[model samples]
Target: MYAIIGATGHIGNRVTDILLNKGEKVRVIGRDAARLQQYVNRGAVPAVGDLKDTAFLTTAFQGATAVFAMIPPSYTASTFRAYQDVVGISIATAILDVGVTHVVNLSSQGAELPRGTGPIVGLHDQEERLDVLRGVNVLHLRPTYFMENLLANVPVIHDYGYAGSAVRGDIKFAMIATADIAERVAAHLLARDFSGSSHEDLLGQRDLSLQEAFTIIGRRIGISDLVYRQIPYDEFEQALLGTGMSRDVCRLFVEMSEALNRGLFAVNRPRNAATTTPTSIEQFAEVFAEVYRGAQHRHAA
Candidate 1:
Protein backbone atom coordinates (compact mmCIF):
# COMPACT_ATOMS: atom_id res chain seq x y z
CA MET A 1 0.00 0.00 0.00
CA TYR A 2 1.06 3.59 -0.60
CA ALA A 3 0.65 6.17 2.16
CA ILE A 4 0.31 9.91 1.68
CA ILE A 5 0.75 12.37 4.52
CA GLY A 6 -0.90 15.80 4.21
CA ALA A 7 -3.52 14.13 2.06
CA THR A 8 -5.79 17.18 2.35
CA GLY A 9 -3.10 19.54 1.10
CA HIS A 10 -2.63 20.86 -2.42
CA ILE A 11 0.19 18.54 -3.52
CA GLY A 12 -0.83 15.58 -1.41
CA ASN A 13 -4.49 15.74 -2.53
CA ARG A 14 -3.41 15.72 -6.16
CA VAL A 15 -0.98 12.87 -5.55
CA THR A 16 -3.67 10.82 -3.79
CA ASP A 17 -6.20 11.46 -6.56
CA ILE A 18 -3.73 10.40 -9.24
CA LEU A 19 -2.66 7.23 -7.41
CA LEU A 20 -6.21 6.21 -6.53
CA ASN A 21 -7.32 6.75 -10.11
CA LYS A 22 -4.58 4.35 -11.15
CA GLY A 23 -6.08 1.73 -8.77
CA GLU A 24 -3.28 1.94 -6.22
CA LYS A 25 -3.97 1.07 -2.60
CA VAL A 26 -3.64 4.41 -0.84
CA ARG A 27 -3.63 5.16 2.88
CA VAL A 28 -4.33 8.89 3.17
CA ILE A 29 -3.12 10.51 6.41
CA GLY A 30 -4.56 13.88 7.38
CA ARG A 31 -5.74 15.90 10.39
CA ASP A 32 -9.29 16.48 9.25
CA ALA A 33 -11.46 13.44 8.71
CA ALA A 34 -14.14 15.65 7.11
CA ARG A 35 -11.67 16.91 4.53
CA LEU A 36 -10.31 13.38 4.01
CA GLN A 37 -13.79 11.92 3.65
CA GLN A 38 -13.71 12.37 -0.10
CA TYR A 39 -10.56 10.26 -0.36
CA VAL A 40 -12.04 7.68 2.01
CA ASN A 41 -15.14 7.40 -0.17
CA ARG A 42 -12.86 6.90 -3.16
CA GLY A 43 -11.27 3.72 -1.69
CA ALA A 44 -8.43 5.30 0.33
CA VAL A 45 -7.79 4.10 3.87
CA PRO A 46 -7.82 7.17 6.09
CA ALA A 47 -5.31 7.66 8.91
CA VAL A 48 -6.75 10.68 10.66
CA GLY A 49 -4.42 12.04 13.37
CA ASP A 50 -1.97 14.75 14.40
CA LEU A 51 1.23 15.07 12.38
CA LYS A 52 3.47 15.74 15.39
CA ASP A 53 2.43 12.54 17.12
CA THR A 54 5.03 9.91 16.22
CA ALA A 55 2.85 7.02 17.34
CA PHE A 56 -0.01 8.17 15.15
CA LEU A 57 2.25 8.71 12.20
CA THR A 58 3.98 5.34 12.81
CA THR A 59 0.63 3.63 12.82
CA ALA A 60 -0.38 5.43 9.65
CA PHE A 61 2.87 4.41 7.91
CA GLN A 62 3.08 0.83 9.19
CA GLY A 63 2.07 -1.20 6.18
CA ALA A 64 2.66 1.22 3.28
CA THR A 65 5.36 0.32 0.77
CA ALA A 66 6.13 3.96 0.01
CA VAL A 67 5.05 7.25 1.60
CA PHE A 68 4.74 10.85 0.44
CA ALA A 69 5.65 13.18 3.29
CA MET A 70 5.68 16.91 3.95
CA ILE A 71 5.84 19.34 6.87
CA PRO A 72 2.54 21.11 6.58
CA PRO A 73 2.38 24.84 7.22
CA SER A 74 1.33 26.02 10.67
CA TYR A 75 0.14 29.60 10.47
CA THR A 76 -0.50 30.02 14.17
CA ALA A 77 2.59 28.24 15.43
CA SER A 78 3.95 30.29 18.35
CA THR A 79 7.43 29.05 17.61
CA PHE A 80 7.43 28.19 13.94
CA ARG A 81 10.73 26.37 13.71
CA ALA A 82 9.99 24.36 16.83
CA TYR A 83 6.70 23.23 15.33
CA GLN A 84 8.51 22.27 12.12
CA ASP A 85 11.12 20.36 14.08
CA VAL A 86 8.52 18.38 15.96
CA VAL A 87 6.63 17.49 12.79
CA GLY A 88 9.84 16.65 10.96
CA ILE A 89 11.13 14.48 13.79
CA SER A 90 7.81 12.68 13.97
CA ILE A 91 7.87 11.91 10.26
CA ALA A 92 11.49 10.71 10.30
CA THR A 93 10.95 8.67 13.45
CA ALA A 94 7.80 7.12 12.08
CA ILE A 95 9.56 6.14 8.87
CA LEU A 96 12.32 4.50 10.90
CA ASP A 97 9.95 2.75 13.26
CA VAL A 98 7.66 1.43 10.54
CA GLY A 99 10.44 0.39 8.14
CA VAL A 100 8.82 2.06 5.16
CA THR A 101 11.14 1.39 2.25
CA HIS A 102 10.57 4.35 -0.03
CA VAL A 103 9.88 8.01 0.73
CA VAL A 104 9.29 11.06 -1.43
CA ASN A 105 9.80 14.11 0.79
CA LEU A 106 8.74 17.64 -0.01
CA SER A 107 11.59 20.01 0.48
CA SER A 108 12.22 23.56 -0.79
CA GLN A 109 14.84 25.14 -3.06
CA GLY A 110 16.73 26.84 -0.21
CA ALA A 111 16.76 23.69 1.89
CA GLU A 112 20.43 23.07 1.13
CA LEU A 113 21.30 26.02 3.31
CA PRO A 114 21.36 25.25 7.02
CA ARG A 115 20.26 28.69 8.17
CA GLY A 116 19.05 32.22 7.20
CA THR A 117 16.32 30.81 4.92
CA GLY A 118 13.73 30.95 7.70
CA PRO A 119 11.38 27.98 7.84
CA ILE A 120 13.31 26.40 4.97
CA VAL A 121 16.12 25.77 7.46
CA GLY A 122 13.67 23.39 9.09
CA LEU A 123 13.49 21.44 5.85
CA HIS A 124 17.28 21.31 5.71
CA ASP A 125 17.26 19.86 9.22
CA GLN A 126 14.59 17.36 8.26
CA GLU A 127 16.72 16.27 5.30
CA GLU A 128 19.58 15.73 7.71
CA ARG A 129 17.37 13.76 10.09
CA LEU A 130 16.39 11.42 7.29
CA ASP A 131 19.82 11.33 5.64
CA VAL A 132 21.32 9.43 8.57
CA LEU A 133 18.96 6.51 8.26
CA ARG A 134 20.63 3.45 6.75
CA GLY A 135 18.14 1.26 4.97
CA VAL A 136 15.20 3.18 3.47
CA ASN A 137 15.50 4.89 0.10
CA VAL A 138 14.51 8.56 0.07
CA LEU A 139 14.10 11.12 -2.65
CA HIS A 140 13.93 14.77 -1.66
CA LEU A 141 11.90 16.77 -4.16
CA ARG A 142 12.96 20.40 -3.93
CA PRO A 143 10.48 22.60 -5.76
CA THR A 144 10.87 26.30 -6.43
CA TYR A 145 8.45 29.14 -5.61
CA PHE A 146 4.82 28.09 -5.83
CA MET A 147 2.50 29.81 -8.32
CA GLU A 148 -0.34 29.31 -5.84
CA ASN A 149 1.44 31.70 -3.49
CA LEU A 150 0.02 34.41 -5.70
CA LEU A 151 -3.38 33.54 -4.31
CA ALA A 152 -2.32 35.16 -1.06
CA ASN A 153 -2.32 38.48 -2.91
CA VAL A 154 -6.02 38.21 -3.68
CA PRO A 155 -7.13 40.06 -0.55
CA VAL A 156 -4.47 42.73 -0.94
CA ILE A 157 -5.49 43.42 -4.53
CA HIS A 158 -9.13 43.50 -3.51
CA ASP A 159 -8.52 45.86 -0.60
CA TYR A 160 -5.70 48.07 -1.86
CA GLY A 161 -5.77 47.78 -5.68
CA TYR A 162 -2.18 46.49 -5.83
CA ALA A 163 -0.02 43.42 -5.27
CA GLY A 164 3.12 43.55 -3.15
CA SER A 165 5.51 41.62 -0.96
CA ALA A 166 8.90 41.97 0.71
CA VAL A 167 10.61 39.98 -2.06
CA ARG A 168 11.98 41.91 -5.00
CA GLY A 169 9.55 42.36 -7.85
CA ASP A 170 12.38 42.57 -10.39
CA ILE A 171 14.09 39.26 -9.61
CA LYS A 172 13.23 36.42 -11.95
CA PHE A 173 12.79 33.06 -10.26
CA ALA A 174 11.26 29.68 -11.01
CA MET A 175 7.54 29.66 -10.16
CA ILE A 176 5.99 26.21 -10.31
CA ALA A 177 2.44 24.93 -10.15
CA THR A 178 1.93 22.67 -7.11
CA ALA A 179 0.16 20.27 -9.47
CA ASP A 180 3.47 19.65 -11.25
CA ILE A 181 5.08 18.86 -7.90
CA ALA A 182 2.36 16.29 -7.27
CA GLU A 183 3.00 14.66 -10.63
CA ARG A 184 6.71 14.23 -9.86
CA VAL A 185 5.95 12.80 -6.39
CA ALA A 186 3.35 10.37 -7.74
CA ALA A 187 5.57 9.23 -10.61
CA HIS A 188 8.47 8.49 -8.24
CA LEU A 189 6.23 6.64 -5.78
CA LEU A 190 4.79 4.52 -8.59
CA ALA A 191 8.16 3.82 -10.22
CA ARG A 192 10.15 3.21 -7.01
CA ASP A 193 13.26 2.86 -9.20
CA PHE A 194 15.93 4.48 -7.07
CA SER A 195 17.90 2.48 -4.49
CA GLY A 196 19.46 5.26 -2.41
CA SER A 197 18.57 8.67 -1.11
CA SER A 198 18.74 11.46 -3.70
CA HIS A 199 17.42 14.95 -4.41
CA GLU A 200 15.76 16.46 -7.51
CA ASP A 201 14.97 20.05 -8.36
CA LEU A 202 11.63 20.94 -9.93
CA LEU A 203 12.20 24.31 -11.61
CA GLY A 204 8.84 24.84 -13.29
CA GLN A 205 8.34 25.78 -16.98
CA ARG A 206 10.60 28.88 -16.69
CA ASP A 207 11.58 31.82 -14.58
CA LEU A 208 9.62 35.07 -14.39
CA SER A 209 9.89 38.14 -12.20
CA LEU A 210 6.96 39.00 -9.95
CA GLN A 211 6.30 42.02 -12.17
CA GLU A 212 6.13 39.78 -15.22
CA ALA A 213 3.86 37.28 -13.43
CA PHE A 214 1.51 40.06 -12.29
CA THR A 215 1.22 41.33 -15.85
CA ILE A 216 -0.06 37.97 -17.05
CA ILE A 217 -2.32 37.73 -14.01
CA GLY A 218 -3.63 41.23 -14.76
CA ARG A 219 -4.54 40.43 -18.32
CA ARG A 220 -6.49 37.36 -17.26
CA ILE A 221 -8.28 39.15 -14.43
CA GLY A 222 -9.02 42.21 -16.61
CA ILE A 223 -6.82 44.49 -14.49
CA SER A 224 -4.52 45.88 -17.18
CA ASP A 225 -2.68 48.21 -14.81
CA LEU A 226 -1.90 45.63 -12.14
CA VAL A 227 1.65 45.75 -10.84
CA TYR A 228 3.72 44.14 -8.10
CA ARG A 229 5.21 46.37 -5.43
CA GLN A 230 8.01 45.64 -2.99
CA ILE A 231 6.52 46.41 0.39
CA PRO A 232 8.83 47.19 3.28
CA TYR A 233 9.58 44.14 5.39
CA ASP A 234 7.92 45.53 8.50
CA GLU A 235 4.72 46.25 6.59
CA PHE A 236 4.72 42.77 5.10
CA GLU A 237 5.07 41.16 8.51
CA GLN A 238 2.27 43.29 9.92
CA ALA A 239 0.04 42.33 7.01
CA LEU A 240 0.76 38.69 7.68
CA LEU A 241 -0.10 39.18 11.37
CA GLY A 242 -3.38 40.78 10.35
CA THR A 243 -4.25 37.53 8.64
CA GLY A 244 -4.11 35.74 12.04
CA MET A 245 -0.64 34.23 11.57
CA SER A 246 1.42 34.25 14.76
CA ARG A 247 4.18 36.84 15.02
CA ASP A 248 6.78 34.08 15.02
CA VAL A 249 5.73 32.58 11.69
CA CYS A 250 5.27 36.09 10.27
CA ARG A 251 8.85 36.90 11.24
CA LEU A 252 10.03 33.71 9.59
CA PHE A 253 8.17 34.71 6.43
CA VAL A 254 9.90 38.06 6.46
CA GLU A 255 13.23 36.32 6.85
CA MET A 256 12.37 34.08 3.94
CA SER A 257 11.57 37.13 1.84
CA GLU A 258 14.92 38.67 2.73
CA ALA A 259 16.58 35.44 1.65
CA LEU A 260 14.57 35.42 -1.58
CA ASN A 261 15.51 39.03 -2.31
CA ARG A 262 19.13 37.96 -1.92
CA GLY A 263 18.61 35.21 -4.52
CA LEU A 264 18.95 32.44 -1.97
CA PHE A 265 15.79 30.69 -3.19
CA ALA A 266 16.47 30.80 -6.92
CA VAL A 267 16.65 27.59 -8.89
CA ASN A 268 19.93 25.87 -8.04
CA ARG A 269 20.19 23.61 -11.12
CA PRO A 270 20.51 24.28 -14.82
CA ARG A 271 17.31 24.54 -16.83
CA ASN A 272 16.97 21.04 -18.25
CA ALA A 273 14.00 18.93 -19.29
CA ALA A 274 14.32 16.92 -16.09
CA THR A 275 14.19 19.97 -13.82
CA THR A 276 11.51 21.75 -15.82
CA THR A 277 7.85 20.75 -15.66
CA PRO A 278 5.02 21.23 -18.16
CA THR A 279 2.76 23.85 -16.52
CA SER A 280 3.26 27.44 -17.70
CA ILE A 281 2.42 30.73 -15.93
CA GLU A 282 -0.01 31.44 -18.73
CA GLN A 283 -1.87 28.24 -17.85
CA PHE A 284 -1.72 28.98 -14.14
CA ALA A 285 -3.08 32.46 -14.79
CA GLU A 286 -6.38 30.80 -15.66
CA VAL A 287 -6.41 29.18 -12.23
CA PHE A 288 -5.52 32.59 -10.77
CA ALA A 289 -8.40 34.23 -12.64
CA GLU A 290 -10.95 31.75 -11.32
CA VAL A 291 -9.74 32.37 -7.80
CA TYR A 292 -9.66 36.13 -8.30
CA ARG A 293 -13.21 36.08 -9.60
CA GLY A 294 -14.34 33.97 -6.70
CA ALA A 295 -12.81 36.36 -4.22
CA GLN A 296 -14.40 39.26 -6.07
CA HIS A 297 -17.82 37.66 -5.88
CA ARG A 298 -17.47 36.88 -2.20
CA HIS A 299 -16.49 40.48 -1.46
CA ALA A 300 -19.50 41.73 -3.42
CA ALA A 301 -21.81 39.37 -1.56
Candidate 2:
Protein backbone atom coordinates (compact mmCIF):
# COMPACT_ATOMS: atom_id res chain seq x y z
CA MET A 1 0.00 0.00 0.00
CA TYR A 2 1.06 3.60 -0.68
CA ALA A 3 0.37 6.35 1.83
CA ILE A 4 0.02 10.07 1.23
CA ILE A 5 0.20 12.52 4.11
CA GLY A 6 -1.74 15.74 3.70
CA ALA A 7 -3.89 13.92 1.19
CA THR A 8 -6.55 16.62 1.03
CA GLY A 9 -4.06 19.21 -0.17
CA HIS A 10 -3.45 20.21 -3.77
CA ILE A 11 -0.47 18.02 -4.60
CA GLY A 12 -1.52 15.27 -2.22
CA ASN A 13 -4.97 15.00 -3.78
CA ARG A 14 -3.42 14.73 -7.19
CA VAL A 15 -1.03 12.06 -5.94
CA THR A 16 -3.85 9.99 -4.47
CA ASP A 17 -5.89 10.28 -7.66
CA ILE A 18 -3.02 9.09 -9.84
CA LEU A 19 -2.15 6.22 -7.53
CA LEU A 20 -5.78 5.07 -7.32
CA ASN A 21 -6.27 5.25 -11.10
CA LYS A 22 -3.30 2.89 -11.45
CA GLY A 23 -5.07 0.38 -9.13
CA GLU A 24 -2.73 1.08 -6.23
CA LYS A 25 -4.09 0.80 -2.70
CA VAL A 26 -3.75 4.25 -1.12
CA ARG A 27 -4.04 5.30 2.53
CA VAL A 28 -4.63 9.05 2.80
CA ILE A 29 -3.83 10.88 6.07
CA GLY A 30 -5.61 14.07 6.99
CA ARG A 31 -6.48 15.96 10.19
CA ASP A 32 -10.05 16.74 9.34
CA ALA A 33 -12.35 13.74 9.15
CA ALA A 34 -14.95 15.78 7.25
CA ARG A 35 -12.37 16.77 4.67
CA LEU A 36 -11.11 13.20 4.44
CA GLN A 37 -14.57 11.88 3.73
CA GLN A 38 -14.28 13.21 0.20
CA TYR A 39 -11.30 10.97 -0.44
CA VAL A 40 -13.01 8.04 1.26
CA ASN A 41 -15.79 8.38 -1.27
CA ARG A 42 -13.18 8.07 -4.02
CA GLY A 43 -11.88 4.67 -2.74
CA ALA A 44 -8.99 5.98 -0.64
CA VAL A 45 -8.74 4.70 2.93
CA PRO A 46 -8.70 7.80 5.15
CA ALA A 47 -6.18 7.85 7.99
CA VAL A 48 -7.18 10.85 10.05
CA GLY A 49 -4.79 12.69 12.40
CA ASP A 50 -2.10 15.34 12.75
CA LEU A 51 1.17 14.61 10.94
CA LYS A 52 3.06 16.07 13.89
CA ASP A 53 1.89 13.17 15.99
CA THR A 54 4.39 10.38 15.47
CA ALA A 55 1.93 7.83 16.87
CA PHE A 56 -0.57 8.95 14.24
CA LEU A 57 1.98 8.72 11.48
CA THR A 58 3.13 5.33 12.77
CA THR A 59 -0.36 4.02 12.46
CA ALA A 60 -0.86 5.70 9.10
CA PHE A 61 2.35 4.21 7.72
CA GLN A 62 1.38 0.71 8.80
CA GLY A 63 1.35 -1.69 5.85
CA ALA A 64 2.58 1.05 3.47
CA THR A 65 5.54 0.26 1.24
CA ALA A 66 6.29 3.88 0.36
CA VAL A 67 4.96 7.24 1.51
CA PHE A 68 4.59 10.76 0.15
CA ALA A 69 5.70 13.06 2.97
CA MET A 70 5.35 16.83 3.06
CA ILE A 71 5.07 19.65 5.58
CA PRO A 72 2.56 22.40 5.06
CA PRO A 73 3.63 25.92 6.01
CA SER A 74 2.25 27.24 9.31
CA TYR A 75 2.20 30.96 8.77
CA THR A 76 0.50 31.46 12.14
CA ALA A 77 3.96 31.34 13.67
CA SER A 78 6.01 34.47 14.25
CA THR A 79 8.67 33.56 11.69
CA PHE A 80 9.20 31.15 8.84
CA ARG A 81 12.30 29.80 10.56
CA ALA A 82 10.33 28.70 13.59
CA TYR A 83 7.71 27.07 11.43
CA GLN A 84 10.40 25.23 9.50
CA ASP A 85 12.03 23.87 12.64
CA VAL A 86 8.71 22.56 13.95
CA VAL A 87 7.72 21.02 10.63
CA GLY A 88 11.14 19.46 10.08
CA ILE A 89 11.21 17.81 13.48
CA SER A 90 7.71 16.45 13.09
CA ILE A 91 8.29 14.94 9.64
CA ALA A 92 11.73 13.51 10.46
CA THR A 93 10.51 11.82 13.62
CA ALA A 94 7.58 10.30 11.77
CA ILE A 95 9.83 8.94 9.05
CA LEU A 96 12.13 7.37 11.63
CA ASP A 97 9.33 5.76 13.62
CA VAL A 98 7.09 4.69 10.77
CA GLY A 99 9.44 1.99 9.42
CA VAL A 100 8.46 2.83 5.87
CA THR A 101 11.16 1.96 3.37
CA HIS A 102 10.82 4.62 0.71
CA VAL A 103 9.97 8.28 1.15
CA VAL A 104 9.32 10.91 -1.54
CA ASN A 105 9.53 14.29 0.16
CA LEU A 106 8.09 17.46 -1.34
CA SER A 107 10.82 20.06 -1.20
CA SER A 108 11.77 23.21 -3.07
CA GLN A 109 14.68 23.55 -5.46
CA GLY A 110 17.83 25.18 -4.03
CA ALA A 111 16.87 23.94 -0.54
CA GLU A 112 20.21 22.14 -0.13
CA LEU A 113 22.11 25.41 -0.02
CA PRO A 114 23.50 26.75 3.23
CA ARG A 115 22.57 29.84 5.22
CA GLY A 116 21.06 32.81 3.41
CA THR A 117 19.34 30.24 1.22
CA GLY A 118 16.11 32.26 1.46
CA PRO A 119 12.71 30.65 2.00
CA ILE A 120 14.01 27.21 0.99
CA VAL A 121 16.47 26.96 3.88
CA GLY A 122 13.92 25.16 6.04
CA LEU A 123 13.39 22.59 3.33
CA HIS A 124 17.16 22.17 3.48
CA ASP A 125 16.89 21.16 7.12
CA GLN A 126 14.21 18.56 6.36
CA GLU A 127 16.42 16.92 3.72
CA GLU A 128 19.34 16.91 6.17
CA ARG A 129 17.31 15.27 8.93
CA LEU A 130 16.10 12.53 6.61
CA ASP A 131 19.66 11.83 5.44
CA VAL A 132 20.43 10.21 8.81
CA LEU A 133 17.74 7.55 8.49
CA ARG A 134 19.46 4.17 8.66
CA GLY A 135 17.78 1.88 6.14
CA VAL A 136 15.01 3.67 4.23
CA ASN A 137 15.69 5.28 0.88
CA VAL A 138 14.52 8.85 0.37
CA LEU A 139 13.89 10.81 -2.82
CA HIS A 140 13.85 14.58 -2.50
CA LEU A 141 11.66 15.88 -5.28
CA ARG A 142 12.62 19.54 -5.54
CA PRO A 143 10.23 21.29 -7.86
CA THR A 144 10.36 24.85 -9.12
CA TYR A 145 7.62 27.43 -8.60
CA PHE A 146 4.21 25.74 -8.70
CA MET A 147 1.65 26.61 -11.36
CA GLU A 148 -0.92 26.70 -8.55
CA ASN A 149 0.73 29.85 -7.28
CA LEU A 150 -1.00 31.74 -10.06
CA LEU A 151 -4.42 30.43 -9.13
CA ALA A 152 -4.20 32.41 -5.88
CA ASN A 153 -4.18 35.52 -8.03
CA VAL A 154 -7.22 34.61 -10.14
CA PRO A 155 -9.21 37.47 -8.66
CA VAL A 156 -6.41 39.92 -9.37
CA ILE A 157 -6.10 38.72 -12.95
CA HIS A 158 -9.82 38.93 -13.57
CA ASP A 159 -10.59 42.19 -11.77
CA TYR A 160 -7.37 44.19 -11.63
CA GLY A 161 -5.99 43.16 -15.04
CA TYR A 162 -2.52 42.21 -13.75
CA ALA A 163 -0.34 39.66 -11.93
CA GLY A 164 2.18 41.33 -9.63
CA SER A 165 5.43 40.03 -8.21
CA ALA A 166 8.91 41.16 -7.18
CA VAL A 167 10.54 39.14 -9.94
CA ARG A 168 12.15 40.90 -12.87
CA GLY A 169 10.11 40.92 -16.05
CA ASP A 170 12.65 38.80 -17.94
CA ILE A 171 14.34 36.74 -15.25
CA LYS A 172 13.52 33.44 -17.03
CA PHE A 173 12.90 31.38 -13.90
CA ALA A 174 11.74 27.74 -13.79
CA MET A 175 8.11 26.82 -13.02
CA ILE A 176 6.52 23.37 -12.67
CA ALA A 177 2.96 22.20 -12.73
CA THR A 178 1.79 20.52 -9.49
CA ALA A 179 0.17 17.77 -11.54
CA ASP A 180 3.58 16.93 -12.96
CA ILE A 181 4.99 16.73 -9.47
CA ALA A 182 2.13 14.45 -8.41
CA GLU A 183 2.60 12.24 -11.44
CA ARG A 184 6.28 11.74 -10.70
CA VAL A 185 5.56 10.99 -7.06
CA ALA A 186 2.95 8.40 -8.02
CA ALA A 187 5.35 6.74 -10.45
CA HIS A 188 8.14 6.42 -7.87
CA LEU A 189 5.85 5.17 -5.09
CA LEU A 190 4.23 2.51 -7.27
CA ALA A 191 7.52 1.02 -8.37
CA ARG A 192 9.02 0.85 -4.84
CA ASP A 193 12.27 1.71 -6.58
CA PHE A 194 14.71 4.06 -4.92
CA SER A 195 17.66 5.31 -6.96
CA GLY A 196 19.71 5.93 -3.80
CA SER A 197 19.92 9.38 -2.19
CA SER A 198 18.97 11.31 -5.31
CA HIS A 199 17.34 14.68 -5.81
CA GLU A 200 15.11 15.18 -8.85
CA ASP A 201 14.84 18.71 -10.15
CA LEU A 202 11.36 18.86 -11.66
CA LEU A 203 11.80 21.59 -14.25
CA GLY A 204 9.20 22.80 -16.74
CA GLN A 205 9.83 22.78 -20.52
CA ARG A 206 11.98 25.91 -20.14
CA ASP A 207 12.45 28.99 -18.05
CA LEU A 208 9.98 31.84 -18.48
CA SER A 209 10.07 35.48 -17.47
CA LEU A 210 7.18 36.74 -15.36
CA GLN A 211 6.29 39.07 -18.20
CA GLU A 212 6.32 36.25 -20.72
CA ALA A 213 4.16 34.03 -18.53
CA PHE A 214 1.62 36.78 -18.08
CA THR A 215 1.50 37.25 -21.83
CA ILE A 216 0.56 33.59 -22.22
CA ILE A 217 -2.05 33.97 -19.52
CA GLY A 218 -3.43 37.03 -21.27
CA ARG A 219 -3.85 35.22 -24.53
CA ARG A 220 -5.47 32.19 -22.90
CA ILE A 221 -7.93 34.19 -20.83
CA GLY A 222 -8.71 36.58 -23.71
CA ILE A 223 -7.21 39.62 -22.04
CA SER A 224 -4.65 41.01 -24.46
CA ASP A 225 -3.36 43.81 -22.25
CA LEU A 226 -2.72 41.70 -19.13
CA VAL A 227 0.39 42.76 -17.22
CA TYR A 228 2.87 41.61 -14.56
CA ARG A 229 4.06 44.36 -12.28
CA GLN A 230 7.36 44.14 -10.47
CA ILE A 231 6.44 45.53 -7.09
CA PRO A 232 8.86 46.68 -4.40
CA TYR A 233 9.72 44.20 -1.65
CA ASP A 234 8.15 46.25 1.14
CA GLU A 235 4.86 46.56 -0.74
CA PHE A 236 4.45 42.79 -1.15
CA GLU A 237 2.75 42.48 2.22
CA GLN A 238 -0.03 44.81 1.20
CA ALA A 239 -0.16 43.51 -2.35
CA LEU A 240 -0.50 39.92 -1.18
CA LEU A 241 -3.10 40.99 1.34
CA GLY A 242 -5.06 42.46 -1.53
CA THR A 243 -4.96 39.04 -3.10
CA GLY A 244 -6.58 37.55 0.09
CA MET A 245 -3.57 35.95 1.84
CA SER A 246 -3.09 36.44 5.55
CA ARG A 247 -0.62 39.17 6.56
CA ASP A 248 1.82 36.75 8.19
CA VAL A 249 1.82 34.43 5.16
CA CYS A 250 2.17 37.42 2.87
CA ARG A 251 5.31 38.49 4.71
CA LEU A 252 6.87 35.07 4.18
CA PHE A 253 5.86 35.26 0.53
CA VAL A 254 7.58 38.65 0.31
CA GLU A 255 10.74 37.08 1.72
CA MET A 256 10.44 34.27 -0.85
CA SER A 257 9.87 36.76 -3.68
CA GLU A 258 12.84 38.88 -2.66
CA ALA A 259 14.90 35.72 -2.55
CA LEU A 260 13.63 34.74 -5.98
CA ASN A 261 14.54 38.18 -7.38
CA ARG A 262 18.05 37.62 -6.01
CA GLY A 263 18.17 34.30 -7.93
CA LEU A 264 17.77 32.12 -4.86
CA PHE A 265 15.02 30.12 -6.58
CA ALA A 266 16.82 29.30 -9.82
CA VAL A 267 17.85 25.69 -10.52
CA ASN A 268 21.49 24.76 -10.98
CA ARG A 269 23.05 21.54 -12.41
CA PRO A 270 20.31 20.46 -14.78
CA ARG A 271 19.35 16.79 -14.53
CA ASN A 272 21.28 14.37 -16.73
CA ALA A 273 19.67 12.70 -19.77
CA ALA A 274 18.84 9.65 -17.67
CA THR A 275 16.12 11.29 -15.50
CA THR A 276 14.65 14.40 -17.07
CA THR A 277 10.87 14.96 -17.17
CA PRO A 278 9.96 18.31 -18.67
CA THR A 279 6.48 19.87 -18.91
CA SER A 280 5.85 23.08 -20.81
CA ILE A 281 4.20 26.10 -19.22
CA GLU A 282 1.83 26.35 -22.20
CA GLN A 283 0.68 22.76 -21.81
CA PHE A 284 0.30 23.32 -18.08
CA ALA A 285 -1.81 26.39 -18.79
CA GLU A 286 -4.24 24.27 -20.75
CA VAL A 287 -4.70 21.95 -17.75
CA PHE A 288 -5.06 24.94 -15.47
CA ALA A 289 -7.94 26.00 -17.65
CA GLU A 290 -9.44 22.52 -17.65
CA VAL A 291 -8.73 20.68 -14.37
CA TYR A 292 -7.64 23.11 -11.65
CA ARG A 293 -9.92 26.00 -12.53
CA GLY A 294 -12.90 23.71 -12.59
CA ALA A 295 -11.89 22.29 -9.22
CA GLN A 296 -11.58 25.82 -7.85
CA HIS A 297 -15.07 26.70 -9.05
CA ARG A 298 -16.51 23.65 -7.35
CA HIS A 299 -14.68 24.44 -4.12
CA ALA A 300 -15.93 28.01 -4.17
CA ALA A 301 -19.50 26.91 -4.77
RMSD of each predicted structure: 0.9, 3.0
Global local distance difference test of model 2? 0.76
Question: Which runs in model 1 stand beyond 4 Å of their true positions?
Answer: 267-269
Clashes, model 1: 0
Q: Tell me the deviation in Å of residue 79 in model 2.
A: 3.2
TM-scores for every predicted model: 0.98, 0.89
Full-model lDDT for every candidate: 0.93, 0.76
The model with the greatest TM-score is 1
Clashing pairs in 2: none
> 142-216, model 1: which lDDT tens digit per residue?
999999999999988999888999989998899999999999999999999777879999999999999999999
